[model samples]
Target: MNKYSYKDLPSRRERLFIALRLPAHIQHSLRLSAELVQGKLDFRKWTDHRDYHITLQFLGDTLVSDIGQLRKTLRSAGAGFQPFELRVSGWGTFGLEEAPKVLWRGIEGELGQLNLLQKRIVEATSSLGYKAELRPYSPHITIAKKFLGQVPGNEDKGIFGVLPEQDLSDNSWLIQDFVLYVTQPGQTPMYEVVDAFSFS
Candidate 1:
């Protein structure tokens, strides 16, 4: 008999769904742009540039046993899409201007294709028993989080400064594939390519 039983073994890892890699030039531009926003507002904890990505879907956590079928389904879903161009620009917040919680950069152009792809992925994954996100998808790169009780436009003294209205030229990126990522609670997440299916 083995010394270790199932109860004594390490738990399975968490799983996530992620988008394909951004072009090098686009990644550079986004990093530089984020630097420009530093110290300008009460930005939430700045995300590391290495961690920057556009999420196609969030699988939350899943058992390792479920990963193989999830990958096959996602590949089939992604195979229907062709590569498209995406533009990133501007600054914005989620929720009311008086009580914003998420600070994000806007994504424009190729919006329709992105939506279609997202819908397909959701449909494909949902068939595999994953909980589907109920919120209407708004694609944006989250940059920061807002403090509690802080309202935008309140001009409260000595708390944090307002983010200046920025004039951003549209930065474009090409999408070629989608990736599957795994997120671990209480640890830096790990990302591995489950499958890379290209669009036209």
Candidate 2:
């Protein structure tokens, strides 16, 4: 018989953060819109299209040993909520006027439902010993980061001539399922369908 150390095990066995999927059409539109502002106003480096998602809760890093219980808790917590429609619109950045670290768009409509979903997710995973977020939840899909000065790498002043404003269209989608995702630095993140408890 041979004994193996924890470091020798495969990395895929790690636990993941979980979130809800954004509909394809809305994602496409957001990508196009982002390109229009690519060189202007010190936008944060953009996230890849496939990485786009509306996070319900950030589970942070967890040991592989804990994933099984997390899944079970999510299933139980998610059982009561039914599918709901969410609309994506508007854009903003975080930080002071001189420095913005994140650029993202806001979610609209079905606000109550979204909040309920987040609360349940938090409740489900709270017992895992992770630190819970104390601030009020504000749902937004982050598009960019790493922004420091006035649009670094661009010398053309014209690039900052016009900044894009938020779009207020009613782009909606039905949320049918959520997912658990494992993110690793310098590697593509992996996702798994923990359990899809359907909404009525």
RMSD of each: 5.4, 5.0
lDDT of 2 by residue, 70-146 (tens): 77787777775788888887776676534567778888888998898888788778787755688898889888786
Worst-scoring 10-residue span by lDDT in model 2? 1-10
Which candidate's lDDT is highest?
Answer: 2
**lDDT (Cα, tens digit) per residue for candidate 1, span 1-200:** 02234244436655566575556666566667667655444445665555566787888767665666777787788875777888876777777666577777788888898898888888888898876678888888776676454344535732224554444454787787777765534543234455566664
| Whole-model lDDT per candidate | 0.66, 0.69
Off by more than 4 A, model 1? 1-11, 148-170, 184-195
The TM-score of candidate 2 is 0.80
Q: How close is candidate 1 to the true structure, as a TM-score?
A: 0.77
Q: Ten consecutive residues with minimal summed lDDT in candidate 1?
A: 1-10
TM-score of each: 0.77, 0.80
The total number of steric clashes, by the backbone 3 Å criterion, in model 1 comes to: 2
The Cα RMSD in angstroms, rounded to one decimal, for candidate 2 relative to the true structure is 5.0
